[model samples]
Target: MHVVVNAATSADGKLSSRRREQIAISGEKDFARVDRLRADSDAVVVGVGTVLADDPSLTVKDEQLCERRREQGDPEQPARIVVDSTGRTPTDAAIVDDAASTYVCLSEAAPVDRRMDLADRAELVTAGEDRVDLLRAFAALEAAGLERIMVEGGGELIFSLFEAGLVDELRVFVGPTVIGGRDAPTLADGDGFVAEFPTLTLESLERVDDGALLIWRADG
Candidate 1:
């Protein structure tokens, strides 16, 4: 299965501020396109911050969009997964409430008791020491029969996967806004990880509506 990173960025290249604020907000077309991408994927993966900030339903909406999904071979819906190293995923988060299937990846640092609680609502998986492991998580999802894994990330998650070379493709939607936040984050791995995507290369770039969507492929 190919792991795909799909995210929206501002014209200025900021995902969100350090305080976890929204920037580079997408227009209706981009928003709908994102949803369509979710629908077309076998699973939708996101970081814990996005869950807390966006509270996205992760389900394909819009009558026309839903119809298009059916044409694309997408059935009911795709599974939703969240990477929460501390097992900090809110029990009442909409992703858990709405997704037909959900998985929460917690780190070994989390207490065994907490794992039980998370497992009751969503399947609990362990990765890394105190941070989620991008390679392990993606491999597990791939083993579970997900051929197309879509990552909708907060900064840290995106950076980790890219740096680890787990990302097989990248689809960036560039919006027409510059929300300048000094603390805004664009994926951070606090342990000072160096990016080593030595074989990844861009495949194509196209202007989609109000913004440009850049596509890249995992190269050998």
Candidate 2:
């Protein structure tokens, strides 16, 4: 399966404020651009942190796009997957709606009540012992027939996937604003690499409004 990471960040690379609040980094044009990417993919994945912060609908909003997918004999909407180790995504979250198939990946340590509560709303997959194992989750997603996956993130999840060398491409929409804070979230968080780190090759650049959209590929 092909794994792609997508994010919109500030000029200083912060995804959001220090307290993890959601910020509007992308403009309307960028939103449409990302919606197109979502419409083109087989599945869209995000961490639970994003869910709690943004409460995203996680579906393609354009009716024309949905019609096009239908005409092509594809699902009207791509499957939604959440890497939620603790099963913290509320059962009533937008992702639990019937707009698309929802899959919640969890660790063995996920709460039983939460798991049971979500059973009817989403497909629960145990992927790791204590945290959601991205590799295992990817394999399960592939097995479920989602080969082209897009990851829309909230820092920690992006870091884990990229650090695992699983991302084939990273598409970042850099906005003009800067909200700098020592505890602010960046593109790749967690215990970042110290040596022998992975590198990215700039693949493309396109300016939009006051910012630019950059695409980088994982170095071979």
Candidate 3:
């Protein structure tokens, strides 16, 4: 399976404010590019923190793009996957709507009631004991035919994917704005790597709506 991570960050390398509020860092052109990326992927993945913070639909928004996907014998929108260790995803979250198939990755430690409730709306995949094991969760996704997975993350999830050596590519849109805060979420936010940091090969760089788009391929 191919895992591609995409994010939009301020010039200061912050994904959002320190308060974890969602902000508009990218412009219209970047939004369109993200829509296209969603339309082309088999599934979109995010962490539970993102769900609680932004509550994004994670569906392709362009009608034309949906049509194109349909013509290619694909679903109107890609599947949505959420990595929630303890099943904190709200039952009414947009990702669980009928617009697309939804999968919530949970751990065995999740409350039975919450798991049952979410199971009514979204498929539940148990991977770890205390936390959602990304490796096992992704393996299950791959077995379900979700080969092209796009990760639209908060920060911790992104770091976990890199730490697990599961990320294949990364595409970042560096917007013109500067959101500066010591506690602000950056592109990858987990325990900082001390040694053996992930390496990347620059694939392409281009100017997009008042911003720059940078693409990199993970080096093994």
> How many clashes does each candidate structure show, in the order listed?
5, 0, 0
lDDT of 1 by residue, 96-183 (tens): 8744688888888877777877777897778789788767876776777878889988777877776777778878888777767666
lDDT of each: 0.77, 0.92, 0.96
Give the Å shift of residue 19 in candidate 1. Answer: 3.5
Cα lDDT for residue 211, model 2?
95
Cα RMSD, each candidate: 2.6, 1.0, 0.6
Checking candidate 1 for backbone clashes, the offending pairs are: 17-184, 18-183, 18-184, 155-187, 156-187
Model 1 regions lying over 4 Å from their true place: 63-75, 187-200
Q: Write the per-residue lDDT of candidate 3 for residues 56-139, one digit (tens) a residue.
A: 889999999999999999999999999999989999999999999999999999999999999999989999999988999999
TM-score of each: 0.86, 0.97, 0.99
Model 2 C-alpha lDDT per residue in residues 75-187, reported as the tens digit of each score: 99999999999999999899989999999999999989999998989998898899988888889889999998999997899989977778999999999999999899999
Better of 2 and 3 by TM-score: 3
With a 3 Å backbone cut-off (N, CA, C), the pairs that clash in candidate 2 are none
Instruction: Report the poorest 10 consecutive residues by lDDT, candidate 1.
Output: 188-197
Which number leads on TM-score?
Answer: 3
